[model samples]
Target: MRTLVVVRHSKAEQSGTPDFERHLAERGHGDAADAGRWLATQGIGPDAALVSSSVRTVETWTDIAEAAGWDLEADFDRGLYSAGPETALDLVRLTPPETTTLVVVGHNPTMASLAQMLDDGEGDPEVAGRMNEDGFPTSAVAVFAFDGEWADLDMGTATLVAFHVGRG
Candidate 1:
C-alpha cells in the first residue's frame, strides 16, 4: 500500500510583497510544527515530499520536517505554486515508485480539491463529511491510502483515511 499526505501551506503574511515571496506569519510556523507533530504521532513518515516553490510553502515544509524529526528533502516545484487539482495530481504521479509514503504541500483550493477528488468514499465517512463541510484551511493535512503505485493513482482511486487541520 502507498500512503499520500496532502497539505495546505500554513497562514502567510498579507503584505505588499509578491505572492510567491510572501513568508509565513508567526502563527503559521507554530501551526505547521503542530501539523508535523501530529503526523509523527500517527506514524506517517513521508519518504518523499513535493512542495510549491513559493516561499511560504517551502517554509511550511521546513517547519513540518523539522518538527516531525524527518531528514527528508522536498522537491520544490514551481508548477505547483498555481497548479489546480489535476495539475497537482500530475505532479504527484511523478513520484518515484519506490516511495511508499509521500507528501505534497501546496496551496488551496488545489490541496483541498485534490484530497476530495482522490477519495473513493470507502474510508471514514465522518472524516470525509467534516472535510467537505469545513473546507481546507491553513495547515490542513489529508491522509490517503492507495493500493497501487504512484503513477497509477487517479481520481477516486484512494481512500481518505484521515483529515486534520493543524493549529497551535
Candidate 2:
C-alpha cells in the first residue's frame, strides 16, 4: 500500500510587513520538532518530500525533516507555496509510483481540505478527530493509505489512516 503524508507547514512568525516572507517563530520550531517525532512513531516517514517555497513552510520542513531523519532531498516548488488543494493533489500525482511514501509540506485549507476531501475507509477514529479538532494547525501531519497508484488517488478514495496534528 502507498502512503501519503500531508503536512501543514509549522507556525511562522507574524511580522509587521505585509509580505509573504515571514519565517517560523520559536514556538513553531518546537511544534515542528514534536510533530516530526510524532510522524516517525507513526511510521509515516517519507521517501521524498515536496515542500513549499514559503519561508515559513520551508523552515517548518527543515525541523521536521531533521527530526524524522528522512534523509531525503526536498523539492521546493513555488506552485505549492500558495496552491489550492487541487493543485496539491496534482503535484502528488506527479510522484513516481516506485516511491512508496511521500511528504507534502504546504499551507492550510489546501492540506486540511485535501484530507477531508479524501474518501474514508477503516480510518483511526482518533486520527480523524485530530484532523478536524484543531483546523489543521502548523506542522500538522495527515496520514493516508491507498491501495492503488497515486495517479488514481482521489477524494474519498482513500482512508484517513492517522493524523498527527499540533496542539496549538
Candidate 3:
C-alpha cells in the first residue's frame, strides 16, 4: 500500500512581507516540530516529499523533517504555492512509482480540500469526522492509505487512516 500525508503549513507571520516570502511565526515552529514528532511516533517515514516553494511551507517542512529525524530531501515546487486540490493531485500523480510513502506540505483550503476529496470512507470514520468538523487548521495533517500506483490515484480512491492537529 502507498501512504500519503497531507499537511497544511503552520501559523505564519502576517507582517507586510509578500505572501510567498512570509515566514513562520514562533508558534508555527513549535507546532511543526510537534507534528514531526507525532508523525515519527506513528511510524511514518516518507520516502518522498513535495513542499511549496513559499518560505513558510519550506520552513514548516524543514522543522518537521528535523524533529522526525528524517534525512530525505523534498521537491520544492512553485506550482504548489497556489495550487488547488486537483492541481496538487496532479503533482502527486507525477511521483515515482517506487515511492511508497509521500508527504506534501502546502497551503490550506487546498490541502484541506485535497484531504477531503481523497477520502474513500473506508478507514477510521471517527478520524474522518473529526477532520471534517475541525476544518484544516494550521499544522493539520491527514493520512490516507492508497492501494494503487501513484499515477492511478484519483478522487475518493484512498482511505483516510488518521488525522492530527499539531500543537506544541
- Please give the CA lDDT of all the candidate structures: 0.95, 0.83, 0.97
Cα error of candidate 1 at position 104, Å: 0.2
Worst 10 residues of 1 by lDDT: 125-134
Q: What lDDT tens digits, residue by residue, belong to model 2 across residues 11-129?
A: 77788854358888898988998888888888776887999888888888888978877787899998997789988999998999898898888887888888788847468777677
Model 1, range 36-155, lDDT digits (tens) per residue? 999999899999999999999999999999999999979999999999999999999999999999999999989999998999999989989988987999999999999998999999
**Model 2: residue 17 alpha-carbon error in angstroms:** 3.8
Query: Could you tell which candidate, 2 or 3, scores higher by lDDT?
Result: 3
Clashing pairs in 1: none
| Candidate 2 lDDT score at position 42 | 84
Using TM-score as the measure, the top candidate is: 3
Q: Is candidate 2 or candidate 3 better by TM-score?
A: 3
Candidate 1 matches the true fold with a TM-score of 0.98
Candidate 3 residue lDDT tens string, 34-78: 999999999999999999999999999999999999999999999
Candidate 2's displacement at residue 149, Å, is 0.6
lDDT for model 2: 0.83
State the lDDT at 66 in candidate 1: 96
